[model samples]
Target: MDTHFIAFVLRALAVRLHTNRDFLSWYEHTKPDFILCTNFLGGSVIASIAKRANLKVPIFVYAADVFNNPKAGYCSKIDRLFIPTELGVKNLLSQGYTKEQVRLSPFPLQPSIQQMEKLSKSEARKLLGLEDCFTLLLNLGGEGIGSTALVKQLIKNKLAWQVVVVGNLSEASKQRFHALAKQLPGMSMHTPGFVSNIGHFMLACDVQAGKAGANALMESLSLGRPFLINELLHAARNTQTFFLEYQVGWVIRQPKQQMITLKAFAEDKTRQQRIEYNLKALPLQFDSDQFVNLLLNEVKSLAD
Candidate 1:
């Protein structure tokens, strides 16, 4: 695993892969039917190896996030490519893949979201211990990085809304939030770090303030809740495109812009209803069983 040793080995393997029999003798003994690669760079290298072997073995590449591949046709080097978003499909096409090679599939959601118990807003609010006041859910997807600033801003300003900040990772972050909560006597806020029952909170809040990550996007769309995206970067940019295409949510750019947007959504019931309607109109969702079946069938065919 030394960097110099790895570079030297790759060079030696490239020069004498077949002649240097011991370098990769494991492949001959193992004779894997196909190689599936989840890692971005490793998959491309593995595919190249299969190509050099005259493709006796096939390659199946799963794109981890939307537009995550760095190289052109990196996933296309494989026999089959599974991309999770329609935007991802376009990215592959731009990278020079044929229509036959790529398949758009749903990103697998958690069991909770798949078997999500549909709750009326009142019921969901009761479960989250939220009052009937305007409610906002602060979830920055699985990473739990952003939203501390927004949390303090709302509480310090004493915004008349119930704010539930879920899924923060570290204890330090949680403490900072709790400490801020104590400073404001009348402000309504809740901080719960990383819960499996995020599905409940998703249904409970009026607006989901977060980044454009897949889980948050899918859950918001599934629950027919408007997602007020807090940032768009890297893979999140692809999510922004999807939201724009469907009019599912507002992509926040400036800090002041989000506050203005939130105020409008808070004050206007009709606009809130409109945003939720757009999110529901989209066909995006997570059917984990069906997604798993697709992968299984592909694997079975290769194995046969």
Candidate 2:
């Protein structure tokens, strides 16, 4: 939020803003120590404005995704860049940015649940109306793809497990899933679209199925849930590396192949147990305090 950023700035140092007619008046009356923009406009636009104003204040561009695809050309005009992960730093370096210009930071999570203790599986499942027996939760980011067909096939095979889809789904897609849910009596299917308490859902279920968005993947790992990631996204390589490093979960290129293996795994209780054990053994690697401190320090350095 703007207010949150403003509060952070005020705590660190003096902050001021001038706009519209007041811009000229403020520029004439006072000189700024630094200028910071939260990527509100394009980097080139910010650079041009600074040039036209004859301001020498350093401009720091806080980028969340710029490093992921540096060819997007948003980092050229900024004095420095702040990225969320070491992976991001590597990406920037590969794109020709010097090491000194890039700072590693952590992505900020909502304060409400960052440090909150995780709930027990049974307690979490009970709250979400999920069965504690055998269930797989698929979180395909915002766009739920290949999961409906996979769930239907799993039910057709008479697997004694429930499938819960926990992302955005169209009404038609939901209706189709509901119909399949009726056909498969032993396999109850629930598509509760977009719940804020997704952490509880992640904890309640045995597995996650989706593309590797950093937010969802981190949450799944934090809750010790094995994930089945789609390997089509640009972040797939990074996700694969993380999973391999941590021994967290499996990755599949084709959804059809994943479904075939999932069907087999669903029927094999021993295999599922083994997978869960491995997931539990994986250590937590995300550190928010380090992330925030790094970002603040970088911003301060740019100001200096």
Best by TM-score: 1
Q: Report residue 253 deviation for candidate 1 (angstroms).
A: 3.4
Give every collision pair in model 1.
Answer: 167-194
Note the residue pairs that clash in candidate 2: none
TM-score between model 2 and native: 0.72
lDDT of 2 by residue, 164-194 (tens): 8877777887788788878767777788977
> What is each predicted model's overall lDDT from 0 to 1?
0.70, 0.64
lDDT tens digits, residue span 16-57, model 1: 555434424767778876676765555656665556656477
Off by over 4 Å in 1: 1-35, 67-69, 72-75, 140-143, 155-157, 182-185, 299-304
